[model samples]
Target: SQQGEEDPQALSIQEGENATMNCSYKTSINNLQWYRQNSGRGLVHLILIRSNEREKHSGRLRVTLDTSKKSSSLLITASRAADTASYFCATDLLQGAQKLVFGQGTRLTINP
Candidate 1:
């Protein structure tokens, strides 16, 4: 798979705690995207970082990319119970093939 791996396969946190996860890839990429998915539902686009960008932020979400290390991280600040979801990182590595591959994902749970 073009996507490498994500650490701490599972996470359990309190509603007010922060959650962070890391993603690594094996191949070069034009862009990397982070997504959130609730149980039995579709994925929600959280943020996107291009090859040139090193960091991005949206609301309480923060994303960082380190091309030199071929790695990325996602941080969700001031987490809420509603923020509990499975987070994934995706990238299209086929060049002209136009296919996006996803990592296995980090399951995050926020307790009240």
Candidate 2:
């Protein structure tokens, strides 16, 4: 399975702090995407970095990928209370249908 697993099931941070999480996958992938879900709301795409890429950043979010190790990390810097959400890593399999398989996810809470 190309599915990925994210570490730190939950995280809490004070406003203006940083939050980091990790994800590990089992197989090769075309690309990996990070998404954020606010409670019951649908996920919102944060960023996507291809397998060939080492790192990418957007706004306050930064993502790093290591294909050799089949793992990735996400960092949210200077987080705000509005940044509190569940984060997930999704990998697009190279061989199968182009669909994203999500990780277990890391729930983040930013206290104001």
Candidate 3:
């Protein structure tokens, strides 16, 4: 499994602040996706940006892709305490079964 690894295993920030997380993968991918998990609940897809795309944004979330570096970064602007959660990056390999391999994730905490 060509899974990615996220840095800064944990992070804490004040409400309304911005949070950034990085992800690095071991293999080429067809696309990359970001997901948010609230506590022990199921993960919810946050964004999906293809290999051909450089960057993407949704609401306060921004994602950047760099195939050359085999890495990606997710940024959350104006984060709220409600946004406190674990963030993971999954890579969809172009070949093989096209399954998603997830990273260890960054545990984010927003202090109110």
Candidate 4:
């Protein structure tokens, strides 16, 4: 499948701790994007990295991509209760017509 699959389907961590999630894809991609969705809400774009980039960071969020292995990881540092949400990874295939394939997503919970 061209869609990416996220690992550790669910994660729970204390406030101020860090949370990490992983995604693996089956086909070549032009770019990868990470998104967050609060309960009963639309998705919020977190970050995007191209196939040429190995790592990227935005605020407390860090993302790393390894094209060789068709894998990517997202790390949220010093997490807060507000960070509780479902995270999804979407990949834009290299040969597709600007389509994105999203994974099942990872459910993250932050405890105070």
Model 4 earns a TM-score of 0.97
Best by TM-score: 4
Candidate 3: stretches off by over 4 Å? none
Report the C-alpha lDDT of model 4 over 1-112, residue by residue, as the tens digit: 5379999899999999999999999989999999999999999999999999999999999999999999999999999999999999999999878679999999999999
Clash number by candidate, in order: 0, 0, 0, 0
Cα lDDT tens digits, model 2, 1-112, are 5389999999998999889999999889999999999998999999999999999999888999999999999999999989889999999988869589999899999999
Error of 3 at 28 (Å): 0.6
Model 1 residue runs over 4 Å out of place are: 94-96
Give the local distance difference test score of model 3. Answer: 0.93
Candidate 3: tens digits of C-alpha lDDT, residues 1-112: 4378987799999999999999999888999999999997999999999999999999999999999999999999999999999999999987749479999999999999
Computed on alpha carbons, the lDDT of every model, listed in order, comes to 0.89, 0.93, 0.93, 0.96
Error of 4 at 79 (Å): 0.4
Model 2 lowest lDDT segment of ten: 91-100
